[model samples]
Target: MTDTTARTIPIEAFGPGAQSVDVPVLDSHLHHVEAGEGDPIVFLHGSPTSSYLYRHLFGLLAGRGRLIAPDLIGFGDSGRPEIAYDLADHERYLDAWFEALDLRDVTLVLQDYGAAFGVSWASRHADRVKAVLLAEPVIRDIESSALPEAFVGAQRVIRTPGDGEKFVVEDNLFLTAVLPGAFLTPLAEADLAVYQAPFPTPESRTHLIRFPRNLPIDGDPASSVEYLARNEAWLASSTDVPKTLLTYEPGFLVTPTIVEWIRENVANLEVHAGGAGVHFVQEEQPQGIADAVVALLARAEAR
Candidate 1:
């Protein structure tokens, strides 16, 4: 029987005092911040952002469970090896990180490329995943016509040989332009500085440059497209998994059409209106996200 007497955990302030612990994974180390104890609730950030993206969530999800957020390899404080920052490389490092931590029965909170990684891992290791919350995830193949003309043009420039390096590396386009534009509220100078700290040198921006180019769009990037298809299939069949999808107004990836498709395809799914935002819903609706996550946890535990 389910524990009906379980009490709700109160949220608190996760202020500037929060610190990250580095764990060695593979040849490098991954920096992560964790709070509370018991079952693990892991948060994964995407391109141009680090675990710092979920700083607000740690406070909101306090005492509910063990909350952990890790910076992906080549981003934030994680070690940047000389290998190409491709999807497979990131996946390999993340797999090692999870093994090193010996994490089990995890609840994943994912965004952007993080969603892709998390969902892929969950599909492969279904027993380890307890629940999943996705916001602005890269879960489907994208059509070129579906994107804004200007955004498509920019992607083309970013995918080109010499121009891609200039646009992403030299100009720091993802950090300078894309990240700021995705947020509804203007990010303060200090907050922007945190996002910029990892990519000080042009060469350090390799992962950022690779992200947009690797987007699974229009049947290209066959590898990502294949994995997304597998994840979609898993989502359809995994009716026992409690999944919550937070959708925002004028969202970049998970548009209304995509949301409707998710409604039809994904099983045991709950959709929550995440209020106004562009791509970065966490910045705009942290409370809403927390509420959804808590509700999903309850549902998962009820089973």
Candidate 2:
């Protein structure tokens, strides 16, 4: 039987009756929020955000399946182990978490670096994934010049040695600047505080410092570039799997150029507009995102 018991996290932003869980994975544990019961519909969040990113989606997607949103290791309520916290580290932890839960026939809702993690995993385990829904995901290698000037500048600074530490660790730029800027409107102080709670000290912000540097910009990070290429090959060839891309007006990552590339290349893909937003489409279009996921699920069921 499915465990419908509610586990509490002291954050009002998660709203009332949020169900939390801490599952053992590797040397650490992954914290997640779950609702309903059936085949797993897993929600994976990206850098600087946690399971709280999908708090609204649980209710919106209620009764669709077992809704689960987990905070990637080193983020949210999850244990911060002594490790490099690189893409490989995150992937390893996530692989263990999925095995621990014994999730099967999963429908994935992914965004940001979560895209990299989920898509790569799905590529390796195609039979296990039922469907995929993505919004502003990191799916390919990007030229540093293709990014916005301000973003490129920020990445350069964050990739620097001492400067990177000061920018993310001391200043907490990811939570204070990058995250808030992703939303179309300003995030409320209360909601922002929920994201801030996990990383209270400079040491706690190690993952934040590492994430930007790990991006596959200009193919400098060969590992990430190779990883993305592998997933891209799977996306192009997996014609049987249903895929949905939720796009927002003037998106941050999935810009028009990239979207066009995706539509042309990825097989069995459907594109839906998620209204006006930047990187964080869920905050601006929770209902739209929910609708898209439902539509994808129906398509997968039909197949």
Best by TM-score: 2
lDDT values of the candidates? 0.82, 0.84
| Pairs of residues clashing in candidate 2 | none
Query: What's the TM-score of every candidate structure?
Result: 0.92, 0.94
Candidate 2 worst ten-residue window by lDDT: 1-10
Each prediction's RMSD to truth: 6.5, 2.5
Candidate 2 local lDDT, 1-303, one digit each (tens) = 133234334433445455677888889888887778889999998878888888778778878888888889988888789999889899999999888888889999999999999998899888899999998898877776667788888888898898988889899887798888877788877778888888888878877887788887888688888877877788999999999998888778776667888999999999988889888777778888999988999999999
Model 2: runs farther than 4 Å from truth? 1-17
Model 1, poorest ten-residue lDDT window?
1-10
Give per-residue lDDT, candidate 2, residue 67.
Answer: 86
Model 1 Cα lDDT, one tens digit per residue, 1-303: 011212111112244334456778888877777788889999998877888888799888878888888889888777788888888889899998898888999999999999999998998888999999999898887878767677788888988898988998899877888778777789877778888887888877866888888888787889878868878788999888999999887778886667888999999999988889877788788899999999999999998
Q: Which stretches of candidate 1 lie over 4 Å from their true place?
A: 1-13
Clashing pairs in 1: none
